[model samples]
Structures are given as C-alpha cells and as structure tokens.
Target: MEALNLTSSGPTTFILNGIPGLEAAHIWISIPFSVFYIISLLGNFTVLFVVAKEQTLHKPMYLLLCMLALTDIGTSTCIMPKALCMLWFGSKYITVDGCLTQMFFIYMIAIMHSAVLVTMGFDRYVAICDPLRYATILTNARIAKLGLVGLIRAVLLVLPLPLLLRRLPFCANRVIPQTYCEHMALVKMSCGDTIMNRMYGLVLTFVIMGSDLTLIGLFYGLIIRAVLRISSKKAHQKALNTCSAHICVMVITCATSLFPALTNRFGQGIAAHVHTLLANLYLLVPPMLNPIIYGVKTKELRDKVGKYTCRM
Candidate 1:
C-alpha cells in the first residue's frame, strides 16, 4: 500500500531501514529497544505523577523537572513506536506528510529539551546567587511564560525546515537508511541539491544549541562564584550538591544529542548502521536516565517517590 503511493502526482512515501544487512536481527534488536522504551515511560511518568501529587514539591525546580519529563516523553514518543513497528512488524514506510510531521516534532522536542535544561540552569542560578529573590524571580506565572517562550522559539526555528524540505522532489529513491525520518537521510532522498538544507540545519543547530549552552554555562559560572564566596563550609558543600545533579543531566543530554549530529555530518568514514544506532541513542538516553539521576540526587523528590511507592 505504501509502495503504491510514491508517485509525484499525488503523495510520496519512503521505506525506513531498521539496519542495513541486519534484517534477520531486527526482531532480536527490538527486544532491548522495547525494554528501554518501557523503562523510560515508567520512570518519566512516575516523575510527572509524583510532582503532581506532592504540594511541597511545587517549586520552580520541580516544575522545571516536570518540563524535562515532558520533553523526554516527547523525544521517545516521536521515535520509539515507529522504530518498534519497523523492527517487529516489518512495516517500514512513511508518507511524505507523515515524515515531515515527525521531523518537525523531533526537531522541536530537541530544541525544547535544550531550553528546559537552560531553564533548569537558570533556576539553579537564582536559587544560589539570589536565594531571597528566587521566589519572586521564578514565580509560577513566570515559569509558565518562560516555557511558552521556549515553545515559540522551537516552533519558529523548526517551522522552516519542513517547508524547505518539501521543495525537494523525490528522485525515485525512497529508501531512508534509518528507522525514523532523520533530516539528512530525507535530504539525501531528494533530486535537488541538498547543500542549502544541510547548511540551514547545521547553522540553526549551532546557533540555538550553542546559545543555550552558552547561557547555561554563564549561569553556572555565576552560581559557582556566589557559592565560593559563602563563608560557611557547610553552605559551600550544600550549594555544590544542589548543582551537581543538574550538571550531570546537562552533560549527559548535551553529549548524547550533539555527538550524533556532529558525527552524522562529519564522520564520513563511519558506517550507516552505526549512525542510525547513534541517532536512536540520542533519543533514548536522555529520556531513560534523567528521572533516575534526579531521583537519586535530589533528596526531597526521592523521599516523595519512596513514600508514594510504599503506599501503592
């Protein structure tokens, strides 16, 4: 049915690759992927639920944690089902419209994920540098507006990508060597020159992610400066402890996301299947680990989770 719809006159469809030359092992591969996906869902959902249940946890940091969980869910949702379908059911076709829709969400989620991290960094900064003003600075309404701004930014930046991609005519090659509709993979399927598309993707990624990372770094720098000035050794250790979890999360997420993009663009000698696997890792790792890191590192959230579990 999908193959029948690849004509230029109507709509275009492309076949998704699970792994080149590893068709026989797709089912085997699905086992671990599915497990990771399930664990991520359970973990992130627990975060959302606990945050909602505990009134005391209704602070700026926890609210931002909720945003992180939401983005994690979004990242996984955009990739996992289609990936699992391709792996398990041997269904691997994505219509042009469907592919574009998926691409938009994937890009938006990534940008928003970065935004949430930066916002969390800001939360930490305010808490440390201006503890008395933290409440007034990051009010509930202000937090909501900050999230809305991030959403708007993500939409405006990602909106052009799908529009730019639509102008490319399919060159009769409908096979994309990845489970999901990655931008470069889709760009390669076009008959036209993809240099501009590649350039736009590269520039936007650097400008937005680069800007976010810079702001986050600046926030941490100020936070550290403030922390070091504190006379009490106990206060110094406490402040550093508060930031350690956020730093760990930031490092894990940024590395997983940026490395695959960089490697995809520059690492020509690498294998295609390896790139695909890395892309999947980019989507999976942040969602799977963020909750665990927070739960282990933050005592309040951890205690709430333990009590909630005992009751259940």
Candidate 2:
C-alpha cells in the first residue's frame, strides 16, 4: 500500500527544520548509536552462537535467552539501518507505505519482546516457585508451543494498526517529524480526528504492555517471597542473582515504553527526544549488555563462551 497522503494542507513534506544549538547533535547521536548497534549485533550473535553450539546450555533458560537475542537483533535491525541511513546519507524521505511497513514491524517486534520477557519471568517463577514441576511444566514441546504462540500474538496484535491507518481519510500533512513513523505520531498527523485510533492504541497498551508488566511484577514478587524464606544465604543469593539480568531488562523496557508518552503529554519535546533515545537504548543497550550480565553472573555461560571462543 502507498503511504497515505493524509496531509490536508498539502502534499506531505519533510523539511529539516534545523534545531538551534543541535547542529552537531546528529553527529553526537550517530556516534553512540553506531557503537550501540555494533555491540548489540555482536553480543546477540555471540549468545546465539554459544547457545547453538553448547549442548549443556540447551535448557529452558538458555532457550529463552536465544529467543531474546533473536528479538533484540530484530529490533536493532529494524530501526538502526534506517536511522544510520538518515544520518550518513541524508535521506529521510520515507514513502507512506514504507513508513507504515516500518511501523508495523517495529511495533510487532516491540510487543513480541515484551511478551518474551513475560514468558521469561514465568519460566523463572516456575523454576524457583515450583522446582519439582519445572521440567514437566516447561518441556521442550511446551517451550516451542509458547514461542510459536508469542510470535502469532505479536503479529496479530500489530497487524491491525496499519489496516486501521489505511482506513483513515488522508486529508492533510504527510510529513512525520520523527525519523521513524511511530503509530501515534502518524495518527496525530491525520486531518480527521483519530479518536478511534487513540482508543484502540490505549486498549492495545493495556492488553500487551500492561498485562506483561503485571505478570512480571507478580512473578518477581513471588520470587522475592520465596527467597526470603530460604534459610541458606548462598541459596537466596543464587536465586536473586538469576533474576538480576531480567530485572534490568524489565526496568529498561518499562522506562522506554512509558516515559515518552508522559513527556509528550506534558509538551516536552526535548524530553520526548530523550525518551526516544532511551527507547532505542532499550532495544540496543539491554541486548548488548545481556551477554555481559549473564556471563559475569553465571559461571556456566561464562566458562562456555570463553572456551568456545578460544577454540576459534
């Protein structure tokens, strides 16, 4: 589908309205983003490689990690290539269809990432909360099923967004201010009121992100309660350590998703941009850091990665 020409005022135009004092900001942003992109790619690839090669790490936890790496890689690949292209090539004019497609995949992956995090939380809870039944509850077949369900869910949840946009009469401006076509941002550009789009988006936010966060909170809370009752210091410490990486990931994801909306509501453009940068970081930084977090904390992954790399 062609990009919706909704701009009522005229044909959508993307003029670079240069921000004062931010002349060098693009350069600064590009440097860090480039570094983050490289790290994210390398780190996730390493995780994927190690998990694929090491038979010992073929358990549920590592399987979930492989999924996480795959999602992270998908996320960075979605945003970074276009972003870097804009920075290096000075090409920011995306067609309406291209913009919609970008939004679709980005939203799909983001929702899927959240779902995967929730699944990981559940996996941890089962391992800690019901160790005796963990194996039976999270079997290889079950994990495969859960993963397939997550994939379908993400696609289903985000697919309708573009269709909804396609239904809207494009009477006005086509130029999106941001580098990427965010759903809400595009909706805002509509000449006609977008009450239905907003309502749908709110419902989606509650269902996908809100539900995932609630489940993650419950899982962590239960884990905390379980850990407190354990008498052995080492046992409690080990349980907490297992959760550290997930907790960091959760915090980053939540901040990235929630903060921008809040800042935008308050009319803070700079804050919104900062939030955008943080949102990108949630995809890039956490993925890059995940390997380090797991490797430093888990002796098994660390040893395996070192041995595996040394052999090469």
Candidate 3:
C-alpha cells in the first residue's frame, strides 16, 4: 500500500473534521453529481459518436468539438470516481503515490482542455476573420498536426510535476485536507519546504496556460473586430451568437482556475475552498452543459443529435 511518509518522530494518525450543519451536504451534492455524471458521459459519448459517424463533421470545428468532448470525459473521469467514493464511503485518505498519480492526470487533462480551447479559438478566428483562407489555413493535415502538437505539449508540461512530488521529503502529515488529490494541497501537507514545487507550478501555469490564454484572447479580439466590420445586421447577430458559447466557457474556466490560485497564495483558506468548489464546477459544468448549450444554440448540431437519437 502506498503511504505518505511524515517527518515527525512519533506515530501519526489522520483525522478529518466532519462539517458542522452540513451532515447531509454530501448526500445533497451526490444527487446532482450523479445525474450530471450520467448526462455528461452520454452527451460526450454521443458527441464522439456523431462526429465519428458523420462524414460532414470531419471538418476542423467538429474535430475540435470531439477533442473537447474527449478532454471533458477525461477530466471528469479523473475526479468524479474518487469524489463519489468519498461521498458514498466517507473515505478521503489517499495514498501518496495514488495522490500524485491523480494530480498528474488531473493537471494534464486540465491543461490539455485549456490548450484545446485555444485551438478552438484559432479555428473560430480563421473561420470568421479569414474566411477566404479558412480552408487552406485549417486543412485536414493541419488539424491533425495541431492535435498532435497539443497532445505533446500537454504531456511535456505536466511530466515534471509527479517527479517533483516524489522527490519531496514529506514529513508526517500524510493526510490531505481536501477530498481530492490537488497538487498544492498535497504540497501543503509536506513538513519540508515546498519552494521548489511552488516555483515549478508557477512556471508551468504561466508558461503553458498563460500563454494559451493570451493567444486565445488575441484570436477572439481579432474575431470580434472582424465581426464588427460586417455590414449586415443579421450576419453580425449570427456571428455574435456563435461566439457567445465559447466566450462563456473561457470566462468560467479562467475565473475558476485563477481565483483559487490567488486566494491560496493570500492564505485565505475559506476563500480558497470556495474557489476550489467553483473550479470543480467549472470543470464539470461545461462538460454537462456544453452539449445542451450547443444543442440549443447551434441548429445544425441540435438537428443532427435529434435525428440521430430518434433513429436510435
């Protein structure tokens, strides 16, 4: 069994504080979480299947949509199984290696999801801003290459984290305060100094996610400008409507992720937990809601899903 090594001289035991006035909180959350998990799984699977089955969706946009669905499935799978276990069994203690492994996959998928969003932004930019060159710019070969590059970058960026965690000399406190194996939370339990881990984390965040966010913002800015220059009122409305879903996703993700990091740095535990909950929501909510959003917002996907489901 994997165990966290604590640095203290005496025997160590872990105790978790049961929440006051929220004895049923776990039960309450479980109901919606279970529902969302089912919906998210089915919805994302349908997306993957529809994209694979339909030759028409072989284009760049649908390819990115498929990638997004895959990432969503991955992200939720990493967290929900353990989360549900915690809810049902009231067991939150995770072994050291297990925690590190969980952290690795969670961060990997989260970063990859962000990278895919940047790719999606570029897809929209080319489709809208450079309509004349969209086909040439985002060809099948190019899309495939982009996917490969995203996968490579995600792996490379997260590779160091687990190695770094393993190198740390953990002193006695093996118990993680949070339900899930969050990277910073694990580091916090360490009795030794975690300056290196913190520094590495900061570098990874800014280098990968920060850069991607900047590029995505730039792409959308150009897209908005291009949209504004259009002469027809109906065309402008259509363009804005198409952009809204992605914009909402971007805002939700960034706010959830960035806020927690900030609050943690400021040593605000309650604020950090709230942000963590929001971040978890940001991760799950989009996956659950994306299909619904796209279905209601985009006539093509909605019609396709409806027809496909009806046939089934």
Q: For candidate 2, what is the TM-score?
A: 0.89
- Model 3 per-residue lDDT at 252: 68
Q: Which pairs clash in the backbone of model 2?
A: 3-96, 3-97, 6-170, 6-172, 7-171, 7-172, 7-173, 8-171, 8-172, 8-173
Off by over 4 Å in 1: 1-11
Q: How do the predictions measure up, each by TM-score?
A: 0.96, 0.89, 0.88
Model 2 residue 267 distance off true place after TM-score fit, in angstroms: 4.2
lDDT of candidate 1 over 78-121, digit per residue (tens):
99999999999999988888988999999999999889899999
Candidate RMSDs in Å, in order, are 2.4, 3.5, 3.6
Task: Give the best candidate by lDDT.
Answer: 1
Model 3, 297: alpha-carbon shift in Å?
A: 1.9
Which of the numbered candidates is closest to the native, going by highest TM-score? Answer: 1
Full ranking by lDDT: 1, 2, 3
Q: Can you rank all candidates by TM-score, best first? A: 1, 2, 3
Model 1, TM vs. native = 0.96
